[model samples]
Target: MRPTVLLFDIDGTLVTTGGAGRRSMEAAFEKLHGRRDACDSFPMSGMTDRAIVRKAMHIIGVEDSAAAIDAVIDAYVAHLAEEVHKVDDQRYLVFPGMREAVKEARSRSGFAVGLGTGNVREGARVKLERVSIYDQFDFGGFGCDNEDRTELIRCGAKAGAAKLGVPVEECRVVVIGDTPKDVHAAQGVGAECIGVGTGTFSVQALLDAGATVAFPDFSHPQALEILLGGR
Candidate 1:
């Protein structure tokens, strides 16, 4: 097989934070700006941590400078450390077949597996550690890398290719995520995306968004083959 890079998205793709992320961000915004509802009802699916904070700042009428956004994210991470544990075990879940699929991919030669997520490094760590899956990925293109999902995906693809000492263009990159944004990001970087309907979006929705393929979850019979770029 040719060298391949597999980038996985964290929330909604591999696991569900069970509202811990939203709660933490809301708490952080309230702690800094005195408005708990600043983030209420905001469409946050697939948005970066920094971007979420930035939007909350705007909703609360606060100035959203880089330093300001950083402050909110810092506080959010602190709250997340506690929130991840607070959520009931049933609420926080690693979707079925995801861990096994990741293991299978990593065990293969010439396959570089890592994260392509919207969470910042610390946030990803806190959430993933709750389920003991944080160490599975050694590198990723995090929200800290770029606020734009496409740019971050590109960054992840580049990093994954570098792990095999190959130029990004020479390696086949596949993104596994659960949102239209994830699909769009993969397309933005000239990579393929395998969309999972583990999140708010349905498989058909992801397909409409232009995913190379879509499945209800990692448990689909043809998932591994499709993910590995086989028919």
Candidate 2:
């Protein structure tokens, strides 16, 4: 088997933040612009953190300048750190078998596991820290890497390949995520995507979106096979 790179998405795939992300973003907008509904009109799924703030600024009739986006992101992260702890435990959840899956992948030889998420590095840290899984992924392609999903996914693949001391082209890169955007991003980089239906999208929907395979969650027996086998 060739050295493989497994990139796991944070939100919805490994864990749900119990609306901590949304609330924090909303609070940031309100604090900065006095408009909490800035992002309410659009879905934040599969969007980069900077992109999300940029879009929300546009919708709220604010100039989406780089500095403005940074301000929102900084504020959002601060709020997220606090909100993650305040949310009801029932609403915050780590999907079934995600930890086991990550652990299993880590134990395998010739495999490197990390994150490929829309969250910027700091935001990713805060969210995963709440669930006690922040240390699993040592490196990633974050929203800060690029506003475009394809570019970020490519960035992640390259980083993973670097960890294995091989060219990205020589490594089999697999992306595990919960959105059609994940499928498209993996395709963009000539990687395969294993879509999970733990998000708003369904398994059939993910398959229709061109995922190599779709599972309800990592708890599915076959999920590990395809994840490890790269077929």
Best by lDDT: 2
lDDT of 1 by residue, 1-231 (tens): 779999999989999989999899889888988888988867889898888888878877889999999998999999999999999989999998898998988888899999999999999999999999888886789999999999999999899988989999899999999999999999999999999999999999999999999999999999988877689
TM-score, cand. 1: 0.98
How far out, in Å, is residue 220 in model 2?
0.6
The TM-scores of all predictions, comma-separated, are 0.98, 0.98
Clashes of 1: 0
The parts of candidate 2 lying over 4 Å away from their true place are none
lDDT of 2 by residue, 147-211 (tens): 99999989999999999999999999999999999999999999999999999899999999999
C-alpha lDDT (0 to 100) for residue 151 of candidate 2: 92
How many times do residue backbones clash in model 2?
0
